[model samples]
Target: MAANYDYEEAPGSYDDVNRQDLGYDPNFVPDSVKSFVVHLYRHIREKNVYEIHQMYENSFQTLSDRLFKDTPWPSVDAVSHYVDNDQVFCLLYREM
Candidate 1:
């Protein structure tokens, strides 16, 4: 027989979600994410694969550390967008 899984709803509305709800430090600074994105863009423009790989690994590690345990990894594009335009991202979440 196959096993069935049940999904649970979040405790609050999506707009209520924040760093704390996501298991991140409430005071976590986004500077690292922003720096990674800036370097990633620079590396891409300069075609520096070695440095790019290093940056990617570092960024992934940071992402893993910031997110809740067991949370699925986000796509690179998603991360990039979040880093580049977090204000817009938060506004969208609030508006939604």
Candidate 2:
């Protein structure tokens, strides 16, 4: 979960789904997630990652701290087009 993200369950909560499809991998465990956050924060601070200005203006989302609590982890679909895929839909609500 990204610290900057608000964890309230709301209409835009699913926005991360779009980011995941765009290229963000959202399945990292807590350790990896923390490491990623630190790395990204550093990258942002150092302006090492390209197009920082563009990324700064874009909308992004991430999961909440409570996202994994008591939750059965779901697998990413083996073959799914994010634009149009039933598997994505299945994965989204399979555990719920």
Candidate 3:
């Protein structure tokens, strides 16, 4: 996780969903979640196995626990456009 993203690298606490507030808004997507999805998608697209593993094992759970612990994740229909396949992503997301 440290190699993938350091506290120094993110500019602000916005990307540290596990540790920062990021101004909680149940109706608004947090910046940290947006950034995590983009970075994870980019890593998956590049076929960077190591980074993907790190993000999957470290970042995904952290954000999920911190941000969506008491709520359901947004539907695949809501976020699948960010990825290539809705069906595949839904399975992968369910695992996450």
Candidate 4:
């Protein structure tokens, strides 16, 4: 089941990391997951470790079950933009 996300990306530059290094995958990332990731970023930025822990321990798993049950989670390439393609964030996300 393909995700029904319509990404409206504004023009941007991906100079921070090698987009190619993320590897190419054409799968669409669901908008909900992308939004969740961005929200997670805010927690990280604010050093809200407890909230982050609660969100990951509860919300993220629930979200994955709801969103990815029908299809595997997409490749890092499809979702990394939400983290601004930061490799550390990508690695952490992959670990989760």
Candidate 5:
């Protein structure tokens, strides 16, 4: 089953190291495994939306600093959702 979540742009330009470095598939993951990640991701986005105006605001200095350590931060448009096999993943995409 697919699920939809409301999300805003993440505060910085960081990518998910778990997905990137590990070459893991969001689909086919276990619910218990992904639940914590989803929760943390949402918590960060919620906090950022409550603080930042522009994607550049990067108002959450700690999160912003770590995330955009070496890259330019992008602007996010909306939250995206997907389900593969029995696993589900959601993300915030920056608008080009």
Candidate 6:
């Protein structure tokens, strides 16, 4: 199912890593995942709604494949809960 997340630019600096530096080691998240997330955030910061939606629609399947290649299927309830929370967060940011 397609997620219904509105694109909204958050207030303040868009550089989340720098602005909210949690002092974690540079290698915490793998480089590949970090790169993907950074790219996604850049589109959001630029308010490129079409591109963001395109990227999510095009890449999520591949991303999920890579992320869960060897893992058991996630529960439907868990997935629904996560997606709902994500939608809420997206709405909150859009309202900012």
RMSD of each: 14.0, 13.5, 4.9, 10.5, 11.5, 12.9
Every candidate's lDDT = 0.45, 0.36, 0.60, 0.61, 0.34, 0.43
Order the candidate numbers by lDDT, best to worst.
Answer: 4, 3, 1, 6, 2, 5
lDDT of 6 at 83: 33
Q: For residues 1-96, what per-residue lDDT tens digits would candidate 5 score against the true structure? A: 212212223322234453335453333232322332344455454675442333324322333354434543332211233122212223332321
| Residue-level lDDT tens digits of model 3 in 1-96 | 346453124433554353345444443555666566667777777889998888887877766766566665555555566666546555776566
Candidate 5's TM-score reads: 0.23
Error of 6 at 49 (Å): 1.1
TM-score of each model, paired residue for residue? 0.41, 0.24, 0.61, 0.65, 0.23, 0.41
For 1-96, candidate 1 gives per-residue lDDT tens digits of: 211111112233241255456553433434434445555566666788777666555544545455434544333444546445555434432332
TM-score of 3: 0.61
Clashing pairs in 1: none
Clash count, predicted structure 3: 0
Q: For model 3, what is the C-alpha lDDT against the true structure?
A: 0.60
Per-residue C-alpha lDDT of model 2 across residues 14-34, encoded as one tens digit per residue: 444443444434453333233
**Relative to the unseen true structure, what is the C-alpha lDDT of residue 56 in candidate 4, on a scale of 0 to 100?**
81
Which candidate leads in TM-score? Answer: 4
Model 6 lDDT at residue 70: 44
Q: Report the lDDT tens digits of candidate 6 across residue range 1-96.
A: 433222222223233333245432332332333444445556776788886676566654444354424443233333333334355434532332
Cα error, residue 6 of model 4, in Å, equals 16
Residue pairs with clashing backbones, model 3: none
> Whose lDDT is higher: candidate 4's or candidate 5's?
4
- Candidate 4 lDDT by residue in tens digits, 29-93: 55656766777777887888886786687667766565454445667787887788988777888
Better of 2 and 6 by lDDT: 6
Clashes of 1: 0
Best by lDDT: 4
Please identify model 6 stretches exceeding 4 Å from their true place: 1-28, 70-96
TM-score of 1: 0.41
